[model samples]
Target: MDSSLIQRGRDRGYLHADEVMAAFPHAEDDIASLDEFYLTLEEQGIEIRDEEESDEHPVPETPPSLLGRRLGSHAHRADPDDSLSSVS
Candidate 1:
Protein backbone atom coordinates (compact mmCIF):
# COMPACT_ATOMS: atom_id res chain seq x y z
CA MET A 1 0.00 0.00 0.00
CA ASP A 2 1.20 3.47 -0.82
CA SER A 3 1.14 5.51 2.36
CA SER A 4 1.47 8.62 0.22
CA LEU A 5 -1.84 7.93 -1.52
CA ILE A 6 -3.52 7.34 1.83
CA GLN A 7 -1.95 10.52 3.18
CA ARG A 8 -3.22 12.43 0.16
CA GLY A 9 -6.75 11.13 0.80
CA ARG A 10 -6.41 12.12 4.46
CA ASP A 11 -5.19 15.59 3.55
CA ARG A 12 -8.19 15.95 1.25
CA GLY A 13 -10.42 15.13 4.26
CA TYR A 14 -11.99 12.28 2.29
CA LEU A 15 -10.49 9.58 4.50
CA HIS A 16 -9.46 8.96 8.07
CA ALA A 17 -6.88 6.71 9.65
CA ASP A 18 -9.38 3.93 10.33
CA GLU A 19 -10.74 4.13 6.79
CA VAL A 20 -7.24 4.07 5.38
CA MET A 21 -6.41 1.05 7.47
CA ALA A 22 -9.59 -0.62 6.27
CA ALA A 23 -8.62 -0.02 2.65
CA PHE A 24 -5.08 -1.28 3.12
CA PRO A 25 -5.24 -3.76 5.97
CA HIS A 26 -1.69 -4.89 5.51
CA ALA A 27 -0.48 -1.29 5.75
CA GLU A 28 -1.20 -1.19 9.46
CA ASP A 29 2.01 -3.08 10.18
CA ASP A 30 3.93 -1.26 7.46
CA ILE A 31 3.20 2.23 8.69
CA ALA A 32 5.17 3.18 11.76
CA SER A 33 2.42 5.45 13.07
CA LEU A 34 -0.25 7.85 11.87
CA ASP A 35 1.61 10.76 13.32
CA GLU A 36 4.70 9.77 11.41
CA PHE A 37 2.70 9.51 8.24
CA TYR A 38 1.47 13.09 8.69
CA LEU A 39 4.96 14.31 9.42
CA THR A 40 6.13 12.73 6.21
CA LEU A 41 3.41 14.53 4.29
CA GLU A 42 4.50 17.84 5.74
CA GLU A 43 8.11 17.15 4.78
CA GLN A 44 7.05 16.25 1.23
CA GLY A 45 5.10 19.52 0.83
CA ILE A 46 1.96 17.69 -0.27
CA GLU A 47 -1.31 19.55 -0.08
CA ILE A 48 -4.88 18.64 -0.89
CA ARG A 49 -6.74 20.78 -3.37
CA ASP A 50 -10.38 21.49 -2.65
CA GLU A 51 -12.95 20.08 -5.07
CA GLU A 52 -14.08 23.57 -5.97
CA GLU A 53 -10.50 24.59 -6.54
CA SER A 54 -10.22 22.20 -9.47
CA ASP A 55 -11.66 22.93 -12.88
CA GLU A 56 -14.75 20.75 -13.24
CA HIS A 57 -17.55 20.91 -15.76
CA PRO A 58 -21.21 20.45 -14.92
CA VAL A 59 -22.75 17.06 -15.69
CA PRO A 60 -25.14 16.72 -18.60
CA GLU A 61 -28.84 16.38 -17.94
CA THR A 62 -30.33 12.88 -18.02
CA PRO A 63 -32.59 11.69 -20.85
CA PRO A 64 -36.36 11.92 -20.51
CA SER A 65 -37.97 9.51 -18.04
CA LEU A 66 -40.80 8.72 -20.50
CA LEU A 67 -38.30 6.62 -22.51
CA GLY A 68 -38.33 4.05 -19.69
CA ARG A 69 -42.13 3.69 -19.83
CA ARG A 70 -42.01 2.69 -23.51
CA LEU A 71 -39.41 -0.10 -22.99
CA GLY A 72 -41.92 -2.79 -21.80
CA SER A 73 -44.44 -2.02 -24.54
CA HIS A 74 -41.80 -2.11 -27.25
CA ALA A 75 -40.53 -5.53 -26.15
CA HIS A 76 -44.02 -7.15 -26.34
CA ARG A 77 -44.67 -6.14 -29.97
CA ALA A 78 -44.37 -8.72 -32.74
CA ASP A 79 -42.17 -8.42 -35.86
CA PRO A 80 -43.53 -6.11 -38.59
CA ASP A 81 -43.90 -8.98 -41.14
CA ASP A 82 -45.62 -11.29 -38.61
CA SER A 83 -48.15 -8.57 -37.80
CA LEU A 84 -49.09 -8.16 -41.52
CA SER A 85 -51.79 -10.39 -43.10
CA SER A 86 -50.71 -13.00 -45.71
CA VAL A 87 -50.50 -11.24 -49.08
CA SER A 88 -50.05 -14.42 -51.32
Candidate 2:
Protein backbone atom coordinates (compact mmCIF):
# COMPACT_ATOMS: atom_id res chain seq x y z
CA MET A 1 0.00 0.00 0.00
CA ASP A 2 1.20 3.46 -0.75
CA SER A 3 1.55 5.49 2.41
CA SER A 4 0.78 8.62 0.42
CA LEU A 5 -2.65 7.25 -0.49
CA ILE A 6 -3.35 6.55 3.15
CA GLN A 7 -2.25 10.07 3.98
CA ARG A 8 -4.44 11.56 1.26
CA GLY A 9 -7.40 9.54 2.48
CA ARG A 10 -6.76 10.73 6.00
CA ASP A 11 -6.46 14.23 4.65
CA ARG A 12 -9.78 13.88 2.87
CA GLY A 13 -11.40 12.19 5.88
CA TYR A 14 -12.24 9.18 3.75
CA LEU A 15 -9.81 6.65 5.18
CA HIS A 16 -8.59 5.53 8.57
CA ALA A 17 -6.44 2.73 9.97
CA ASP A 18 -9.27 0.18 9.91
CA GLU A 19 -10.12 1.00 6.30
CA VAL A 20 -6.49 0.77 5.29
CA MET A 21 -6.07 -2.64 6.90
CA ALA A 22 -9.22 -3.91 5.19
CA ALA A 23 -8.15 -2.59 1.81
CA PHE A 24 -4.63 -3.93 2.04
CA PRO A 25 -4.50 -6.85 4.44
CA HIS A 26 -0.80 -7.29 3.71
CA ALA A 27 -0.18 -3.83 5.14
CA GLU A 28 -1.36 -4.72 8.64
CA ASP A 29 2.11 -4.38 10.10
CA ASP A 30 2.71 -1.14 8.28
CA ILE A 31 -0.48 0.36 9.70
CA ALA A 32 0.92 0.08 13.20
CA SER A 33 4.19 1.59 12.01
CA LEU A 34 2.33 4.49 10.39
CA ASP A 35 0.34 5.09 13.57
CA GLU A 36 3.57 5.22 15.53
CA PHE A 37 5.08 7.59 12.98
CA TYR A 38 2.10 9.92 13.23
CA LEU A 39 2.30 9.79 17.02
CA THR A 40 5.96 10.74 16.90
CA LEU A 41 5.16 13.68 14.65
CA GLU A 42 2.46 14.86 17.09
CA GLU A 43 4.90 14.51 19.98
CA GLN A 44 7.21 16.91 18.15
CA GLY A 45 4.34 19.45 17.80
CA ILE A 46 3.48 18.78 14.16
CA GLU A 47 -0.20 18.96 13.37
CA ILE A 48 -1.95 16.00 11.72
CA ARG A 49 -5.58 16.55 10.91
CA ASP A 50 -8.53 14.40 10.02
CA GLU A 51 -10.73 15.46 7.10
CA GLU A 52 -13.15 17.36 9.30
CA GLU A 53 -10.37 19.43 10.79
CA SER A 54 -8.32 19.80 7.60
CA ASP A 55 -10.50 22.66 6.40
CA GLU A 56 -9.84 24.55 9.64
CA HIS A 57 -6.15 24.69 8.93
CA PRO A 58 -4.85 26.89 6.18
CA VAL A 59 -2.56 25.33 3.61
CA PRO A 60 0.88 26.88 3.55
CA GLU A 61 1.74 28.98 0.54
CA THR A 62 4.58 28.01 -1.75
CA PRO A 63 7.88 29.86 -1.41
CA PRO A 64 8.80 32.38 -4.09
CA SER A 65 10.81 30.96 -6.98
CA LEU A 66 14.56 31.56 -7.23
CA LEU A 67 14.71 30.17 -10.78
CA GLY A 68 15.03 33.57 -12.43
CA ARG A 69 18.07 34.59 -10.37
CA ARG A 70 19.58 31.14 -10.69
CA LEU A 71 19.25 31.24 -14.46
CA GLY A 72 20.86 34.69 -14.58
CA SER A 73 23.91 33.56 -12.56
CA HIS A 74 27.09 32.87 -14.50
CA ALA A 75 29.10 29.63 -14.28
CA HIS A 76 32.14 28.32 -16.14
CA ARG A 77 32.86 24.74 -17.21
CA ALA A 78 36.33 23.39 -18.04
CA ASP A 79 37.09 23.23 -21.77
CA PRO A 80 38.25 19.90 -23.23
CA ASP A 81 41.41 21.55 -24.60
CA ASP A 82 42.37 22.75 -21.08
CA SER A 83 42.99 19.15 -19.91
CA LEU A 84 46.59 18.17 -19.03
CA SER A 85 46.38 15.28 -21.58
CA SER A 86 45.46 17.73 -24.32
CA VAL A 87 48.39 20.05 -23.41
CA SER A 88 50.86 17.13 -23.46
Candidate 3:
Protein backbone atom coordinates (compact mmCIF):
# COMPACT_ATOMS: atom_id res chain seq x y z
CA MET A 1 0.00 0.00 0.00
CA ASP A 2 1.19 3.52 -0.77
CA SER A 3 2.33 5.24 2.39
CA SER A 4 0.90 8.58 1.24
CA LEU A 5 -2.58 7.06 0.77
CA ILE A 6 -2.30 5.31 4.10
CA GLN A 7 -1.31 8.60 5.71
CA ARG A 8 -4.24 10.35 4.08
CA GLY A 9 -6.65 7.76 5.41
CA ARG A 10 -5.04 7.99 8.81
CA ASP A 11 -5.31 11.76 8.88
CA ARG A 12 -8.99 11.71 7.92
CA GLY A 13 -9.93 8.62 9.92
CA TYR A 14 -11.73 7.48 6.77
CA LEU A 15 -11.28 7.07 3.03
CA HIS A 16 -13.67 7.32 0.12
CA ALA A 17 -14.78 4.02 -1.37
CA ASP A 18 -13.53 5.23 -4.73
CA GLU A 19 -10.13 5.97 -3.27
CA VAL A 20 -9.92 2.48 -1.86
CA MET A 21 -11.04 1.00 -5.14
CA ALA A 22 -8.36 2.92 -6.99
CA ALA A 23 -5.69 1.89 -4.55
CA PHE A 24 -6.50 -1.76 -5.05
CA PRO A 25 -7.63 -2.12 -8.62
CA HIS A 26 -7.47 -5.87 -8.34
CA ALA A 27 -10.18 -5.66 -5.74
CA GLU A 28 -12.54 -4.58 -8.49
CA ASP A 29 -12.32 -8.02 -10.04
CA ASP A 30 -11.82 -10.11 -6.93
CA ILE A 31 -14.27 -10.01 -4.05
CA ALA A 32 -11.85 -11.88 -1.77
CA SER A 33 -9.11 -9.36 -2.40
CA LEU A 34 -11.51 -6.51 -1.71
CA ASP A 35 -12.54 -8.10 1.55
CA GLU A 36 -8.91 -8.52 2.54
CA PHE A 37 -8.19 -4.89 1.67
CA TYR A 38 -11.07 -3.78 3.86
CA LEU A 39 -9.70 -5.91 6.67
CA THR A 40 -6.29 -4.32 6.27
CA LEU A 41 -7.77 -0.85 6.43
CA GLU A 42 -9.73 -1.74 9.53
CA GLU A 43 -6.54 -3.04 11.14
CA GLN A 44 -4.89 0.27 10.30
CA GLY A 45 -7.71 2.22 12.01
CA ILE A 46 -9.12 3.73 8.86
CA GLU A 47 -12.80 3.69 7.92
CA ILE A 48 -14.46 3.42 4.55
CA ARG A 49 -16.94 6.23 4.40
CA ASP A 50 -19.06 7.67 1.64
CA GLU A 51 -17.43 10.26 -0.64
CA GLU A 52 -20.32 12.66 -0.13
CA GLU A 53 -19.09 13.42 3.35
CA SER A 54 -17.49 16.87 3.33
CA ASP A 55 -13.77 16.99 3.89
CA GLU A 56 -13.67 19.62 6.61
CA HIS A 57 -10.89 18.27 8.78
CA PRO A 58 -7.45 19.64 8.10
CA VAL A 59 -4.69 17.21 7.34
CA PRO A 60 -2.35 16.91 10.26
CA GLU A 61 1.40 17.05 9.70
CA THR A 62 3.12 13.69 9.96
CA PRO A 63 5.51 13.55 12.87
CA PRO A 64 9.03 12.22 12.39
CA SER A 65 9.55 8.53 13.09
CA LEU A 66 11.89 7.22 15.82
CA LEU A 67 14.55 6.47 13.23
CA GLY A 68 14.24 9.97 11.84
CA ARG A 69 14.59 11.39 15.36
CA ARG A 70 17.82 9.43 15.88
CA LEU A 71 19.22 10.52 12.52
CA GLY A 72 18.26 14.11 13.23
CA SER A 73 20.15 14.03 16.49
CA HIS A 74 23.26 12.82 14.69
CA ALA A 75 22.91 15.57 12.09
CA HIS A 76 22.60 18.21 14.79
CA ARG A 77 25.71 16.89 16.50
CA ALA A 78 27.59 17.16 13.20
CA ASP A 79 26.47 20.78 12.84
CA PRO A 80 25.59 22.11 16.24
CA ASP A 81 25.07 25.63 14.94
CA ASP A 82 22.96 24.73 11.95
CA SER A 83 19.45 25.96 12.58
CA LEU A 84 16.52 27.37 10.63
CA SER A 85 17.41 30.92 11.68
CA SER A 86 20.91 30.50 10.20
CA VAL A 87 19.52 29.66 6.75
CA SER A 88 19.50 33.03 4.93
Each prediction's RMSD to truth = 12.8, 14.2, 11.7
In TM-score terms, candidate 3 sits at 0.49
CA-lDDT, candidates in order: 0.56, 0.55, 0.76
Off by over 4 Å in 2: 1-27, 57-88
In the range 1-88, model 1's lDDT, one tens digit per residue, is 4676756665653434454455557665767665565565556665434446433545856567855675756657666777446756
Worst 10 residues of 3 by lDDT: 70-79
- Point out the higher-scoring one by lDDT: 1 or 3: 3
Sort by lDDT, best first. Answer: 3, 1, 2
Per residue, candidate 2 scores C-alpha lDDT tens digits across 1-88 of 3557546655664444444455556555667766765565455454544547644757755555864555454646567668676654
TM-score of 1: 0.26
Worst 10 residues of 1 by lDDT: 46-55
- Residues 1-88 of candidate 3 have per-residue lDDT tens digits of 5578778988978889888878777765788767876777899999887766745666866576765765664664446777899878
For candidate 1, list the clashing residue pairs, or say none.
none
Q: For this target, which candidate reaches the highest lDDT against the unseen true structure?
A: 3
